[model samples]
Target: MEVSRSMKDIQWLRHRVGQFLCVGFDGLTVPSHVNDLLTTHHVGNIILFSRNVSTTEQLIQLNQELQTIAKQGGQELPLTISADQENGVVRRLPADIPGLPGNMALGATGNAQWALKSGQLTAQLLRHVGINFNLAPVLDVNNNAKNPVIGVRSFADTPDMVADFGEKFIQGLQSQGVIACGKHFPGHGDTTVDSHLQLPTINHGRPRLERVELVPFRRAIEAGVDALMTAHVVFPAIEPKPIAATLSRRVLTDLLRQELGFNGLIITDCLEMNAVANTVGVGRGAVMALQAGADMVLVSHRLDRQLDALASIVQAVETGELSQDRIDDAYQRVANLKKARLTSNRRVRPWAQLIEETRTLQHDLAEHAVTKLRWESPLPPSVRRVAVLVDERVPVMVAAGDNHSPVLLADALQAVRPDLHSTVFRFPETLQQVRTDDLLAQLRQYDFVLIGINGGENKDYLEFVHQVHAQSILNVTLLLRSPYDAHLVPQSTNLLALYENTPWMAEAAVAAMFGGTADGALPVRIP
Candidate 1:
């Protein structure tokens, strides 16, 4: 007996339900268990991270294998391979791969074209590696200086600047066939708590949100971004306590869908994060997110949680808790995205030379973006012995295993000043680990001191930097992660906000230090 057309339609949708999920797997290579999601479940998207990337060659081979597995599954849409290629600290790509100068660095340049070029270059590289989705150009306005998570990831402090640069970046990426995801919608810029730790509450009323956070998102939507990721933070103005934009009808459906008119794929930030799991647990949160308005639920980092979450969504739909129409709508939006970008007929480029060529582009962006907030004239000569002090808070590169961009800074400085004697000290994050007396002694010995503030979100490091600067540390140049760090180091000294500790920015900083012209202007205000 032949199956009825309605029955076939339902079967298509059952496969599509799996497409609604964008899940991650366990290792740097294809794990045997991933076949469970691939063949049996018909999952249509896969997220990659440091645990799943060791080298560019590995990544390329991994993507090829993933595509083969996905193709063999016989799904209508190809698996949307994606990664958080935001560069700087959040970059998931291998360390050697050329990365953009991150958002804040681009913002400091105050040139939308630089951001566009950055996005385009980034897309070119990610595409070469077989990844088509880039969760990037984070449009969050970094209005809150002490915001634990967003800091340098945000483009600017003002909505207008964020909007202008964000749209341009989106244009650059999608133009290159890589999907640009404008993230943490309704904005994750103001929160103090990290979603990886707990749910953050953003009490900004609709008016405040409209003036600040919502502006960039509206601009992104107008600019035609392919995807928008929801924030896990609760907004009292839109929804009650505990119901974040990730799982709120008011925020997601009523506000983003109806008011803002964003028809693109709406993805949830990783459900396995403490923000969602602590509140609703991953499985229940996934169901609620689908019910709320999310098109794709991202269950990254935990395989058990991913399977459980997918199972929950399917069960919820079967039980009528989540409307089948919602699933169909979401699945269709994802399908449309795959149809548009993940084309089978596109010519893939040979990337052996791509990295070298793009490294030039990445360096240009960093050079154009290094801000000279206050440059002391006749900045210390290359012959002078230099001491570089890195903040204890800098995070190690996840995939490169132990890639510290500051080492690149030291190497660059040494190359430019062959006679330069350099002493670089890594400050520990804890007060117990800080050897202030020992550090001060080295500062006194060197002809000049250069402090590298990597991830300067901690107030403790600010105070530490202030103490060193107060001792009349002569000819010091502060290479900052956030200009907000200016609060600690006064403008009386040579201050430069590279915006992030990218190697390209580090090379740019070295150039500016040795009397090279720095044309970068401040992109954010600091008091």
Candidate 2:
């Protein structure tokens, strides 16, 4: 069938409708080609990745340029700029912004007020850099200790615990008018694989899912989250098809929309992820995602691919394969989101007040989260010597491949106790190499032995803990990266799970170790 003149009028309709499609750009500045693309295709939103960001001033300039491009293209609409500012390791503005602890750290304190403070600090930092949206407050319940990616990112292992912390975080962000997105819906916290590399499958049926994974999301929705991002994992038992949640209507439309009644915007994780890109072409993935009920398709990279996908979507609508009503619905949702953002008074409050509030809450929460796993003897009146065994796999922001050896811990200990003598032992490989003679010698010398498990791989850490059966020694294990390693230490040991391995956590650990304050228990259980 020959297309009608009205249908062929792509340029006229592009201004009003097609601009809802968001795409990324190549350079730091919005190039002329990007302006042309926006003018010609009406692309609406832009997502900033690590490549697009360098400093706070640069990010603000880039966002200004993008808005200018939108205006020059004859579109008066405000461009939505988003970034992954989850704090800790996922921070984009590391230099200017203060590195705060992750969600699990707040949850560990079992305090809702700290979660609210984290949100406020995060939102203030984001607004300073002109970012309007934060894809954060990962609502997944980290029930599985073997979960590779979502361990420390999640607030806690229990749904109620996660919900308690996440609800406050969402409210804190939204209270400042920054769009808070609760993500990886239905959930990604229980999977053993990372979605960036491949698709993960969750075996829990609907009932178990409602009780565990779905609880936090449900509470977040009820608490009024501004947006929701779908996961790239598949629940084979629930959806049967091998498609990720981003492309599955059973997960997105039927479950999240109809069942849970979430009326806010729905966004895909990222089209560039292997879970979507490897299975289907970006063009088809875009079409399916819209058909599956996504308000925004986040293309982290590959601008040309996103343009092609947009063109394909336009063609589908013209050919009668896709309904114009569906297109209109998504366009309206996007426009509404932009309109809401424009009207929002997201102004910065006093910086000193914000910082003071953040510090006060952080100190309080850290004090509550420092758990005493095992204390063999009563508190000694005088300290003698201490030895700290540090794991080498934890990720440092400045250093790429390094370990959290005993040196860092000993320094922290010394900072708390000036008179205490400290010794450091760096474990190059497995703990098996640390001979029993060496272990016994160290055990005999030190009044207390504090072991720090830096990251996820804890086979050696656990074995080393079991071998050192010293009753006089207080085994204080600090979990830096993933809290899953907390289970490796015996229940009798003095264990403290800090969730994140950031510099701030190191400082918090120092304060909590010397009885300066009482840190709370583990927010999540270790089974």
Best by TM-score: 1
Off by over 4 Å in 1: 1-14, 348-353, 380-382, 393-408, 426-445, 455-473
Q: What would the per-residue lDDT of candidate 2 be over residues 95-210, giving only the tens digit for each residue? A: 55456767777777777888887887788877767788888888989888777667767878889989988899998888777889998899998888878778899988888998
RMSD of each: 3.3, 4.1
In terms of TM-score, how similar is model 1 to the real structure?
A: 0.91
Question: In model 2, how large is the Cα lDDT of residue 202?
Answer: 93
Error of 1 at 181 (Å): 1.1
> What TM-score, over all chains together, does every model reach?
0.91, 0.85
- Tell me the lDDT of candidate 2: 0.73
Weakest lDDT window of 10 consecutive positions for candidate 2: 395-404
Residue 207 in model 1: lDDT: 91
Question: What is candidate 2's CA lDDT for residue 391?
Answer: 64
